[model samples]
Structure formats: C-alpha cells, structure tokens
Target: MARNPERRTALVDAAIEVLADEGARGLTFRAVDARAGVPVGTSSNYFANRDDLFMQAAARITVRMTPDPAKVEEAMRPTPSRELVADLMRWLVQRMEDDRTGYLAMLELRLEATRRPALRNRLTQPVRANFDESARFHQEAGLPGDADAFLVLYLAMTGLLLEHFTLPGVLIGPENDLQAEATLNRLVGTVVTRVIPPS
Candidate 1:
C-alpha cells in the first residue's frame, strides 16, 4: 500500500532483524519501527497487517540470500563437476554465515509457517521455485548429479544450517570436530558423484 520502494525495503529489512532476534511473536510494527528507527506507525503504514509484514520479510530473505550475478557467472564459468558443486555448496554456507540474521529470519519464517496455513502456502511458492530452479540449473549446467542429488543436499544443508545457527555447539565449538567447511565438503562429495574427465 505504501509505495515508497526504498522505505519499504528498509522497513522489511528491519522486520527481518526483528523476526530473527525476537521470533514471530516479537515481530510487531512497533518493534520494526524501533529497529528501523523510523516513526512508530511507519511500519503499519507500509504493511497492510502483521501477516503482510511476515510475507514481506519472507520474500526479502530470498532476495538477500540470492548470490551476486557476477559471482554466479564466475562460478558457472568453470566446467560443471562434483568438485565445482562442492565449491558452490561451500559458497552457500559462507553466504548464510555472512548473513546470519537473514538466514535466522528465514528459519523463524519456517517455524511461523507451521502454525499459519496461509503463510505456509505463501512461502511454499518461492521455496519450491528455488528448489526447482537449483535442480534445473544443475541439470542445465551439466553438473555431476541428478535432481535427487540436489534434493538430498538441500535437505542435508537445511539440517546443517539449522544446527549451525540454532545450536552451534552441536557441530561447532572446541567440543565438536565436525566443522562446517569439512562437513559440507563431505556432504557434497557423498551426495554428488564425481565426474571423471575423458583421458
């Protein structure tokens, strides 16, 4: 409803932080306004309701998590191989690590979706599209795996991210030897068959 693109983006970004830090329950227009340092009613003006704000935050997380086009081009320039796939998986983990709040917000959205069917349906489109797009890209690029590989890795990575963020001690820290990079490489290697170049 509020048509200012920049302001809207800012408000949604702030909402993302609130969602991550405070969870869905803590996500209020007042919370968003305080996080954004805007007027108290600014978020209410921008969003139709809390559900609208949640949907917007969900959408924004996708945009924030998308890789840079230049980086994508660079990654794509290499011949598609299991090794390349591992590299890309590592890149994904790195991106999530770098944007921890964004990823955490996404996790919060996933939790919220379980309770709200409408929100679940709204979030499914992009999530499914992303999964399909990743599988399509892998096949189109001649990557050394089928759609199943992507699906398995997707599930594995989802678990990995969940543990890495919500319970870091589970996979990280001095007590644990299962580090993120090594664990991801192993996951990709196990899931994606190695492509042998012709002699």
Candidate 2:
C-alpha cells in the first residue's frame, strides 16, 4: 500500500540468500524475514507471494552480477576486440566465482521456473533482454562478432560459469585463478574470432 523500496530490496536480497542456501523449497516469507533480520511478517509486507519474491530476487541477482560499465570502458581502451572479449569473459567468470551463492540461487530459480508456466513467462523477457543488451554492447564497442556469435558465447560461458562455480575442484587440471583465466580466454577467443555467416 506504501512505498518502501529499501525494505523491499532487503527482503529480496535475503530471499536470494535463503534460495541459494536452502534451494527453492526452503524459500518462504518466514525464511526471508529471518535472513533479513526483520520482524516476522516483514517479507510478506513487501512481497505479495513466494513467486513474486523469487522473481524479484532473480532480477536483482542479475543486476548485482552485471559488469561495471566504467571498468568495461577502461578495458575497451587500448585493447583489440578479441583481447577485450577475453577480458570481459575473465570479468564474468570472476563475478560468478565471487558470488557463487547468488548464481546458485539464480540457477535454482531457473529450475523452479520450468515447472511454473507463469514464472517461466516472466523470466523469458529478462533473459532475452540480457542477450539483446549484450548484442547491442558488442555492436557499440565495434567488436567483430555479431549478436549470433555473442549468443553462442553466452551459452558456452553460462555452462562454464555454472560448472566452475557450482562444483569447485570438479573441473580438474590446475585449480589456480590464472589457469582458469587462461582457459576462459581460450574459450572466449574461439567464440569472438569465429567468422559469422550472412544473415
């Protein structure tokens, strides 16, 4: 009935933590309120229902996980497009590694969406928007790749981030950050350097 942006944000963030820690099944208004350290019913005051809370949290996680624009611009300067793409991929992998829990929670939400048509429909828009925005950014940066190439890169990178962060030590090979970055670079290079066919 009233505006409480900060409280709503807090509730959504708490919901994310609970979703990540306890999976989608454990996400309730009560759990969110507890995680937010707010009084009982606080989460309900903000979110009308569990689905609302989850969808909001999913959007917030993407917002929090997006690359910083200033840094992206900085990386763009004095670097070739291929090299810049590698830099961008490195940044993306680092973000997932740093916020493993949030990403895990996002994955949980994605799985939950499959069973709920309404939620899946809501999520579809933002998912497409992400790809659209990425394609726009690549074009603006004068990158060699097209939206199609970036789409392929997105799919590959999503798998890489999901596996690398979700199950540490499962990837095998060297476990250090440099080695991981190198691997990401090669993967990114492969995508960015590929020749796109006429549309």
Candidate 3:
C-alpha cells in the first residue's frame, strides 16, 4: 500500500500536539495514532520508529516557534536598525509568551538530540542558519563583523526570552509592556557597546 502524505502530515501534527501537551517523555506511537485519529499501524507505517516521529515533530515545532525571516524583513524594512532590533526583541518575547508549550517541546527535543547523533545532524542546519542570519543582520546594521559577539548577543536575547517565559512573575512587573521595553533598550545598548568602538 502506498503511503498517504496527508496522513503522514496529520501524524506529525498529532505528534507535536502530544509532545506539547504531555511532554517528550509521554510521546508514543499509540498516543500519536490516537491523537491523529488513525489506526495503530498508521503511525508506525509512516514513522517506522520513535526517533523518526520525534525528529519530524521537533521540526514542526521549531518551525512554529520562530517567525518567517521574509515577513520579519518586510515588517522592519522601513524601520531604523535600532528600532528594528527592538521590534524583533519584542516579537521574540511575544513568541515565548504565546507558545510556551512549543518552546518546551523544542527544548526537550534539543536535550534528546544531545544523545542522538542523527537528530543532532538533522537540527544542525537550521540552528546554524538562525545564528548565521543573526550575524549577517548585525553586520548589515553596521555592527562589528565579529561572529563571537553576534553569537553572544543572540544567546543573551534568547536567554532573556526564555527566563521571562519560564519565570514570568519573577522578573517582569505588573506593567509587562513597560518592563519588556526597558529590557530591550538595555539589551540593545549592551550590544551596541560591544559591537561598536568609540568614535
């Protein structure tokens, strides 16, 4: 029997939902099949193994967690570089706040990839691409073309977003918008100091 692409996609989507709702430890072929409303053998036919299903689910979640670069570029096209960074920072915070489940699932997958070489290779390209884009954007914005500094800024921004989401009430005040704006301003100022030398 031929495989159904629609069913395969449905299974992958179901796997993502299962991971998000129940965490990576709760994922199973049976669970995915049930969530997908397909026969028990259906997920097995498509995925062949747990690792296969997990990689697909992780890819789907990763895609959902980040904004499309094209759309981001278009939205910031008319904005100044500093303003664009601030907007991107705001967007990152919003994504963290809106999709905590998806982010958690991604983190779970990342941890698993540490022990699974195949999964690590599968994720390496996308991870590298994200870092590369950050570096290129900083360079284009007249920052020093230091890859290390760009990576530090990227990691710092991501860390802040994660911390805010995982511990929302701790760092953020009653006025979250104001707090986020202040945080972004400070982050951008630090990046500027590191990326630019005194004139």
Candidate 4:
C-alpha cells in the first residue's frame, strides 16, 4: 500500500518483531508503531490491515529462516547422502535455537492460519510450494528416497523442533541427551535408512 520502500520495509520489519514478541493477538498497528519506535500510525500507513501485516511477516519469516543457498550447495554437492540430510537438519536445529523468537512467531502464525480461511489459503500455497521445491531439490540431486521422503522428514523434524525448543523438558527426558545435534542426526538418519527408499 505504501510506496515509500524504506518506510514500508521498516514497518514490515517492525511487524515481524511484534509478531515474534507479542504473538498475533498482540500485533496491532499501535503495538507495531511502538515496537518500531516510529510515529503512532506508521504501521497503519504501510499495511492495510492486521492480516496484511501477518502475510508480510510470514513472508519475511521464510526469508529470515531459510539457510543460505551457497552453504547448502556446498554441503549437498559432495553427496546427496543421508549424511547431507543430517547436516541440513543440524543446520535447521541450530537456526531454531539462534532465532528462537522468529521460529516461535512462525509457530504462532501457523496456528493463526488454521482459524482464518483467508489466511489459511494464503499460507497454504507457499507451504506447498516449499514442500514441492524441496522435493525437487532432493530428487534432482539424486538423493536417496523419493520426493515424499523429504516431506516426511520435514514433518518429523518439525515435530522434534517444536517440542524440543518450545516445550523443552517434554522431549528431553530420562534417556535423552542434551545435544540437539544428536537428536537431529538420529531423526534424519532414520528417515534416510529405514523410512525412505534407497534407490
């Protein structure tokens, strides 16, 4: 809505911060203005509504959370082996810890999508595209396992990440060790070995 790119970027970035710190319910134009330390109606000028802000924030999350492609290419080029997948999972887990608030807000955005039809539809397309793109990457790289395998790994690791980071002790109990890398190794290895096709 706003043509001023710098101001718009500032508002969107501020919206992301608000979403992360305050959750969706707490993300108001006023809240965003205060968080951005701008004028009282700065966010209102940039975004049409809260859902518009939500969409922009969600889009920003994808960009912020994705691993660097150069690093990924370097990592995966050596081999499309299970070890590569494990390394990727490790990267994801490390990112989750490093950007704790960002991932937490992502989870919040996901929940919000479920209740709102427009939001759900808006979010679902990108989610599917990400899945498809990952599948293609794994398949094209001649990785062990089919396209669906990556999808399953995504689901599995998502669950692990959610519980491990958000609920902490709920996942790390008696027999579990404190190292997330170990858990990611196990999860990725299992998917490649036992779950996904080797051919």
Candidate 5:
C-alpha cells in the first residue's frame, strides 16, 4: 500500500465523505479520488481493498469524533456537578451539529457492519472502549451519577442524534435545532439530578 502518511490520511478522509454520501455500496476508489481531487486510482494505491478502505475510514471518523482536549480541560476546571455534566452533554450536541458529516459517515459504517462480519469485528472493540473510557472518565471527573447515568445519557443522545439527522421532522419539528438544545437539557436533567439553588 502507499505509505505517504499525509496522502493516506487525505484518502481516508475523502473515503469517509464518499461513504457518508453514497453509503457502503456507493464507496469506490474512483468516487474517493474524485472527492479528494486526486488522480483516479489514487485510493486503490492507499487501500488494499474495499474492506481496507472501510476500516481506515472508520478509524478516521473515530479521531474526528473524539472530544476536544482543550474543551475537556475547560470542563475539568469547573467543580464537578450536574450542571457541568449538562454542559459536557451540550458540548457533544454542538459537536454533532458541527461535524454532521463525520457522524453520518459513522452511522453508515454501522449499517454496513451489520452485513460484514470482519468490519463488525473491527468496530466492536473501539466502540466498547469508547463507552468504557467515557464511563471511567465520568467517575474520575467526579461528575454526578455513575456509569449507568452515562450509559443512559449516551443511548438517549444517540437516539436523538439519529432522529435529528436522518428524520429531522419526527422528533423536533419546525424549530429542530432549538428543540434539540432544550431536549438535550431535559435529557441531562432527567438522567442526572438537578442542582437545587439556594433560596
């Protein structure tokens, strides 16, 4: 395979866009090359086969979706409380809005995985590790609630994002974005107990 790191990364990123736009069946070396503006057959040089391309695209999206380190630092600076937890959740929502394509690509990969056992095996560990790390982080950060809280919020927000991106009108109609913000806050509140203000 081609070994130029920068070029490889670009090819993978381009492949992600193709996967998001065209789904697994639509992903091809030519499509990726066109999307990346590279010469035809460039993607094939970087990737061994379609499976290689799919794995690389999945890895790229994982990096893209990871939480911002500076933002994590800022969140840690605050006293760990329910409000801070809510803020973190809001940050995730904001990220989805900003990187909608990456998330869509991830969703596409998930669908494709259902049909490809090798891809399924490749993805299972990272997805579980992310969840495990998230639970550990919540505990270490002294955030309100436990691993269960994080799990619930994670699943709820995943469902919300799926609906918001795939079928916007279903869950939060008309003013979708605005409703998503409010709905996220409510979800956090329900999962993590609210802080009572001093009278």
Candidate 6:
C-alpha cells in the first residue's frame, strides 16, 4: 500500500510535540493520534509498534533540534574562531533554554536505548550524525580534525547541558540566562582550548 507522505509527516511532527511535551513515558498511540488529529488506529498503521513510533519521533525531533548551519553561518559571518565558538555556545545555550522538555525527552530516549537493542540502533544514527557534524564544524573552523576529541567534547557538553536542565538548582546556584551562558562559556572555552591547539 502506498503511504501518504503528508499524513506521515504530520504524524511525525505530532509525535515530536508529544515526546517533547510529555517525554517517552507519555508517548502513546492514542496520544499521537489525538495530536495528529487522526484515528487511533492510524498511528498503528504508520508504525507497527511503540518502538517504531518512538524511533521516528526521535529522528524528527533530532532534526528539529539540531542547529541550523545556515543560521549559524549567518550569525557568525566574518567572525574568528574564538568568536564563532562563543556564538555557537550561545546558540546552544539558547536552544537548551527554549526546549527543556525536548532535552528531557532525549534523556529518556538515551536511557531507554540502553535496554532496548532496536532503540539503540535507531538512536545511534543521530548520535553518529551529531558527532560527524561537530567534527566537520571544527575542521571548518581550522581546528584539528580529531574525532576522539570532538566526541569527548560533544559528550561533555551534552552531559553538562542535560544535567543543567534536569537537575536544575542542584548543579547551578540560580537558573538564569547569565548563569547558564557563563557556565557554558567556561565549559566550552576549556573544551576548545584542550581540543584546539593555539596557532
């Protein structure tokens, strides 16, 4: 049977909204149907199981969450590496600021991937793509193309950001833009210095 691309796209978008708003624990076929404004069985028809639905939702959310290179480039036009890195960090902090729910959903998916082999594979694709993008971005910024270092920094930044979001006051004194940017700036500066050698 031919699939309806428009309907599939709508369902995926709805799934992202549900996952972002309610996390994986709250994701249900009926909920997705409600969000998509389709019959309950429609979700099942598009996705055979919850895992499949979650996988698609995660992929769509990842796409939506990732930084837009065009926007980054526009913002960083004629900027040097140091300034560019700062800009990138600021952008990341802004994203983390705007989407705490989505961040928590990603954390839930990460935890679930550990126990579910199928989910593991599905999640790994986005993980690898993120790392690849980071590596490419660093290389473009005239930094060494050290995949290991990129991976380490990526893991550290993501961990710190997720912790900041999830644990809130536990990790930082106050929850504010200045505090978040300061923490991210310090962490990003440290990682950049460690990974990118002085010219």
Tens digits of per-residue lDDT, candidate 1, 19-133, equal 9999999999999999999989999889999999999999999999989989999988887776788778778878998999999999999999999998899889999998888
Error of 4 at 141 (Å): 0.6
| Residue ranges of candidate 6 with Cα displaced over 4 Å | 144-149, 175-199
Worst 10-residue stretch by lDDT in candidate 2? 190-199
Candidate 4 clashing pairs? none
Candidate 4 achieves a global lDDT of 0.76
Q: Highest TM-score: which candidate?
A: 5
Q: List the candidates' TM-scores in order.
A: 0.88, 0.85, 0.76, 0.86, 0.90, 0.79
- 10 residues in a row with least lDDT, candidate 6: 78-87
In order, the Cα lDDT scores of the candidates are 0.83, 0.77, 0.71, 0.76, 0.81, 0.74
User: Roughly what TM-score does model 4 have, to 2 decimal places?
Assistant: 0.86
- Could you tell which candidate, 3 or 5, scores higher by lDDT? 5
- RMSD (Å) per prediction: 3.0, 3.2, 3.7, 2.6, 3.0, 3.0
| lDDT string, candidate 5, 48-128, tens digits | 999999998988988999988887897689888777776677678779888888889999999999999999988887999
- Measured on C-alpha atoms, candidate 5 has an lDDT of 0.81
Better of 1 and 5 by lDDT: 1
**Candidate order by decreasing lDDT:** 1, 5, 2, 4, 6, 3
Q: Candidate 6, residues 17-118: lDDT per residue as tens digits?
A: 787777777789899899989976888888878998878877876876887778877865754565455457657877867866566677778887888898
Segments in model 2 whose C-alpha atoms lie over 4 Å from true places: 173-199
Q: Which ten-residue region of model 4 has the weakest summed lDDT?
A: 172-181
Which pairs in model 1 have colliding backbones? Answer: none
Candidate No. with top lDDT: 1
The true-versus-predicted C-alpha distance at residue 83 of model 4, in Å, is: 1.3
